[model samples]
Every structure is written in structure tokens, then in C-alpha cells.
Target: MKWFEGSVADAISSAQQKRCLFIVFAADEQPASVSTQESWDSDAVGSVASSSVALKVTPGSDSYTQFTQIYPVTIVPTSYMISPLSGGPLEVVQGTASTDELLAKLQSAQEKLTSAGSAMAANTAGAAPAQASAAATAPAPQTASGAAASTTPAAQQPSNEDKIAKARELIAMKRQQRQEEEKQKDLDSELSRRESGKKLQEYKAQQKSREASDRRKEMQREKDEADRAREEIRRKIAEDKAARRQKQSGSAAASASSEPVSATAAAAAAPSVARPPSLPSDMARIQFRFPDGSSLTEDFSSTTQLSVARQFVADRVSDRFPNGFSLCTTYPRQELTFEVDDQTLQELQLSPRSAVLVLPKTTGKQRRGGSGAGAATALSPDSGVWKIIMIPLLLLQAIWQWLTGSAASSSSPSTPAPSGSQAASQPMPQASSSGDAAEARQRRGRGPETGSSFGVSKEGRVNRFKPNDGGDEDDDMGTWNGNSTQQQ
Candidate 1:
């Protein structure tokens, strides 16, 4: 489509002179307009439109204004085909069209233009005779009346130039409206984007704060648990210490109760001994544990003689151990006998807070008794001595009873009487047998009735003795007895 570079009126005059169809293309910068232009420029459509006079008109141009007066373009990319003879549109293609469609439209417009030209020629030849005949029979016209004839004919209908101006105004108004709409749409899009971004930032901040709060709560919970664990440990430690202290106090009280009153009174009445001038004035506190699980505490000057300490203990336990007891220390175990008695407590390092043990002295007689025949004689009924004596005696008694089963019955008065001498001799044997039976009964009675001699009897006379280095010893100094010395 080679568009003629001329004004709309000139293009129409040229089409009339050439006796061809006048083509007008109206378009804008819109994409549909460009597509339509391309279609028309193609070889197929261009070849078909080549014989016609083609004019291209865009918006806001003089040619567009001139063309839109007769054909107001409501949509862009419109094509108009005007007849050269009639100067009226023959075909109109609105919006974009394909190459084939454009070709068909051009062909149709050309046929219409050719038909219009033929009609005009036929009408011209026929109209010449009609005019001659009318001239031959018609009368001359009368002149118009004075002023009415002079007045201008009634105002003619609006011309093409007026229509073109109105179309231009409309196009301008629509273009302004489209510009305003695009501006408003852009503003709306920007505002929405900003609002969304703000919401996202706020959500992120809230999530971060929530996470931090959760972390803090977890830390606090862990700390609380740790504190509880530590408190439980501390409570357990305190309870154990209290239990130990109570046990020690109970034991001390039991030991003190078992001590002799006479010895305790004597100890209380004794005067405090003077200490050596070289020693410090601080007193030493000593704890004494007796063999019976009893305990006592005493205070003494550091320089006081060890003999005085020994005397103090001696007086308290004098009745229980007439031979006296010995004292010893446990840490660096050493006996505190008469040999160390003359030494000052400080010299023996028995100062500050020290613990001593009271062990009963072992006498020569007690040791001898523990190791010798006296020990065997003093044994309980469960001892080997009692087992040896009782088992055989029991067996002998059973045998004797079996053998004498019918002797007494057979010796009845039924037999004839013996001589007087024989009878006197039989009486001596009977007396000896009766005496032996009495001795055996006495021995059986002396033995413990129950299995264990040390066990308590109905009389509550069971004696409990401690084991010594020499083995077992009697609590009494005189003789063995199955009774406590205290009970005796």
C-alpha cells in the first residue's frame, strides 16, 4: 500500500481524474492499527490496492480530520473505499483484517466503483434528451417576490468542515480520558505494593519477637529446674547431717546411763589439777568411747598431767573394774598405760579435740582362765565338754534300762529266801547302785535344759561376756557362773 502524500481533497480529486477507487486508511499508534497497516502493506493486498488511489491518515492530522467528517471512525485501524464517480464510501473495514480479507474488500470496492461509473454514464445519456424535451414544453419561471426573494436561502445543513471539527473534539476528549485512567491505575498499583510490603515487615518483626520470647521462657525454665535440683541436694545433705548428730547423742546418753553412780560422783568431786606454766591456757576437750558403746566428754588444761586424766576415768569406772582400765587413742593407736601417765597431756599430743577409747585391762588370772582347763569347765552346755559327757551317758542309760528290764520282776518274793550272809551282801550292792543313780540325776539337773547355756532362762540370769584377746573370760573374778555379775 503506497499511500499518496497529499491532502484528503487532493487525493479524492486525483482518484476522480484517474477514474479509480479512492482508498482511505485511518489508524493510530495502537497495536491493532500497526497490524492492519502490515496486512495492507503485504504483497497480496498491496497488489490488489495498487490500481486505486490510497491515502493513509493518522489521528490528530489534517487528513484524518478531513476524512472522519464523512466517516467517523469509532475504532482504530479502519479502511474506507470511496467511489470516484459518487464520491461516497463503497466498502468499510473496521479493526485489523487478514491479507485475504483485505484483498477481498479491495476487489469488492473496485467492482462497486465500476458499477457506479456505468450507472452514471447511462444516466447522463438519458438525461440529455429528457432535458431537451422538458425545455421544448416548459413555460418560463416567474420572478421571486420582493424581499423574500432577496433573503438568503434557509441555512444549509452543517458542512463537512463542521463535522470534522466536532470529530476532532471528541477524539481529544477520549484520549484525555484514557491518559487519566492509565495514571490512576499506576497510582493504585504503587499504593498496593507499599501496603503489602509494610504488612510483611510487621509480620517479620512480630515473629522475631515471639521467637525471642520463647527462647527466654525456655532459659528461665531450665534455670528454675537447675535451682530446684541444687536445693534438693542441699536439703538431703542437711538431713543426713542431722540424722548423724541425733544418733551420736542417743548413743552417748545410753553409755552415760550404764556408768556407775559412785564412780561418776567421785569424778565430779575431784579437784582440777594445775597445768605446767609452759603450756597454753586453752583447755583440751577429749571424748572417751568405752567398750560397751558408751561415750563421755571431758575438758582439761593442755599442760595437765596424763595421770590426772587417768584418775578421772578410774574413779568413774572403779566399781566395774577394780583392777583399773587402760586408755588408748585411735588415730595413731597407742595405749595410755601407767608408763605414759606421768607425762603432761600436751606432751602426749592429746590436746584440742581428741578421741580416746577405754579398754578393760586383762589380768593374769583372767588370761589363765581363758586358756586353761578352767575355761573348759566354765563352758556353756553347748560346749564340746558337755556334748562328750552327755551323749555317752545318755547311751549308757538307755542300755542299762534295756538290760534290767525283767531283773526287778524276777527278784520278787516268789523265789526262796537267800541265806542271811547272802542277803547282807546283796544289800551293799543295792546301796551302791542307788548312790550312783542319785549322782547321775544331780549331774543331769545341773546341765542347761535348753540347747544354749548362754540363752536367758525363766530366772533371767543369762550372762553376756565380751571376747578378750585370749578368747573368752568370765565376768566374775572368783568362779564361773551362768549369771551376770550385775545380777549376782
Candidate 2:
């Protein structure tokens, strides 16, 4: 008879595929006794091994551990019939068995298989009414049905000696079984006690951990309270000192007022620059003196745009200039006009600690009233002032550009040419004038509103307005920006 022998996994796979049993023997056992060899050499035992997957690995090997885990082996030579896929034994035989015992066990397994098939067929066919009634009423059977019952021996009357021997053997088996049960019970109690002890230890550890965490939290809370108490005491001390100083100043004021006129004048003449408290330390200190003689002194952060300063002045004054006013710096004394609305105070380079005059815009340029002590309006997409003024200007400018572009396109040559907007953008061919004395004057009078090519004057004359009168007149000699010289 041939047998397969290898690792646990290999034996298992072959057993499952061949539908056979896996039998293993302990290699560490004292060499097989004569009785064990005789049992193994029997025809029945040899046939069993030949018909199944068989393995005999060393006892203490890694494969042995794996094999023991899959199919429990409390004793060896241990034989287990198993399905390889489940990794568990279906039937187990502990210790060496005689040839007849092994053959009987195999026959019993065959009987069980036949019984399971019969039961399955019976379930599929379902029970008849008569059979169901009979089964419910019938008492238990004395022996197994079919072949099992046929093999069973019938009861017999026995001699006294024979009966005594049988009774003694039965008593011995029952006593052994009772001893094993007591030992199992004691082991179970020990395991339960150990489990309870482990739980207690875990519980005590958790309690200690919680206590440590609580102690840390208490310490942190105490420290925070102490710091707050110290801060409160310091604040109270500062307040008390300030109160005493204020009381002393009140008492000394009247006496000092009578004693210092010349001294006061000297102090006032000193170069002590005043500034707003909120100004950053690095910014220039500036004093704005209005035409009304009222002045504002503030520390100015150089980072703030010049427009912010103009808005600051506008916010404080009585005359509400609608178009916004200009800031004229002193010493160099020039009106801050170029890019006035966009320039930064730092970029304009206004002198530190110097004075500037806040002048109201002239009557004709006043667009709206924006003067008050209220907070300055922040710039946004929907700005109140720009919506009123810029929107109309942008619309008009777009219309003019479109009209010019259309006219240029119509007058372009018949051949395919670039779009009028591109053509208009290209520089026109330069032509020298005949040297007219009025040409300079002609250039000045070219108002942005006039229809002309290359910004030349469309009309030599424009309407002029008198300061006193609200009406306009077509004045030939009037300058365009009022800065151009009139030759007449």
C-alpha cells in the first residue's frame, strides 16, 4: 500500500481532493513498540493508510504546531478524518488501535454516511401521514436500524462468575469516567478564577490612570487661578496710582495757572509736535491747518494713501466739498494735484512733523457734499460717488470710441483691411503744420468732448462760464484748461 507524506498543508490538500483521511504519528515518541508495529503491519491498518493522505513529521517541528492547530491532537499516534477546506477533523481516533478496532471504526463511519443519505432522501420525499402518526406514538428503538441492528448481538442469561466479571469491568469504566469529570471541573474553576483576577487588575489600572489625569487637571486649574489673582492685584494697584496722580494734578492746576504766562509761552514756542494717539510710532506727525485757522494734528502712518488723508480732512470740516478738496503742503508750498486721488502719503513724501493746509475746491468743480464728522465711506464696487459721476463718463467714452471706430471702418479702402479699431490705434502719418502762431492755441482748445482725429480741435471756440453768472457764452479767446496763454 502506498501513502502520501509531506507538510501538513500538502497532506490536507491531497486528503480533500482524494476524499480520504489524514493520519499523523508523533516522531518524538520512543521507537514504536513491538505491539504498535504489529498493529500497523496488519492488513486492515495498511489498507486504511493506503486509502488516505498520511503524514509523519517530527513532533516539535513548525509544521507539527500548524497541524495540531488545524486538527487537535491530545495524544499520538493520532488519526483524524478531515475535510481539508474546513481545517478540522470530522472523526478522530486517539492512541493506537488494533486491526479489528480500526476496521470496525471504518465500518461505523460507512454506516453513518449511509444513514445521513437515507435521512436526506426521506426529507426530500417528506413523511407519509401513517408514518408520521406511527413515529410520534412509537417508543425509542433498542438498537440501530438496518445493518447496525443485524450486527448487534441479542441479550443472553449469564453464569454468576461471568456476570460478576462483566459488572466489575463496567464499574471500573464508570469510576474512571467520574475521575476525569472531577479533574475537568477543577480545571474549569481555576480558569474562571484567573479570568476574574485579570479583570480586577485591569479595573484597578484604569482607576489609577483616571486619578492621575484628575490630579494633573487640578494642578493646571490651580495655577491658572493663581495667575488671574496676581493680574487682578496688579491692575488694582495701577488704578489706585492713576487716581492719586489725577487728584494731585487737580489740586496743583489753579496755583500753577497764576504763576506761568511767560513760562507757558516759552513751552508753547518749543517744537513739540502733536499727534493722534492711534498713529503708529514709525509714521510722520502732520498738522493740517484749515483756511479758517482751525487745525488738526495727527500722527500719520506713511503707509496710508494720500486719499485717506484727504478723506480724513473732509470728514472733520464744515464746508462739504462734493468733488473733494486738495491738500497743499507748506515749506515747498505746492498743491498736491497730480494723481491726488490715488497717491499714498508715503509716495508723495510729505515732510515729517510739517503742516499742510486743507483748502476747499473752487465752486465750479464741487460735485457733491461729502463733509461731516461721520466715519469715512470705504471704497466698494457700488461706491456712492463714483456711481454718480464715473458711470456716466465711462458710458460716454465707450459711445465715442464705438462711433469713431465705425466711421473709420466706412472710409477705409475697398481692399481687405484690418478692423477700424486696430487701424485707428496705429499712429497716423506725421504731417508738419504751416507754422501758424495760433496752432499752439488750437491744440489747447481740443476738449475731450469734441469730435476730432488725433485729438485736434474740432471747433476753434468753446463755451465759457462767468463765476457770477450761471449762463455760458461762445468765447473765442477763452483758454481750454484756463492754464493756456491767450495771445489776444
Q: Model 2 over residues 204-242: C-alpha lDDT tens digits?
A: 999999999999999999999999999999999999999
Global lDDT of model 2 = 0.57
TM-score of 1: 0.29
TM-score against truth, every candidate: 0.29, 0.23
Give per-model CA RMSD: 28.7, 25.9
Residue 22 in model 1: lDDT: 89
Name the runs in model 1 displaced over 4 angstroms: 132-488
Residue-by-residue lDDT tens digits, candidate 1, 166-210: 656655655566457557867997999999999999999999999
Tell me the number of clashing residue pairs for each predicted model.
0, 2
The per-residue C-alpha lDDT of model 1 at residue 412 equals 15
Best model number under lDDT: 1
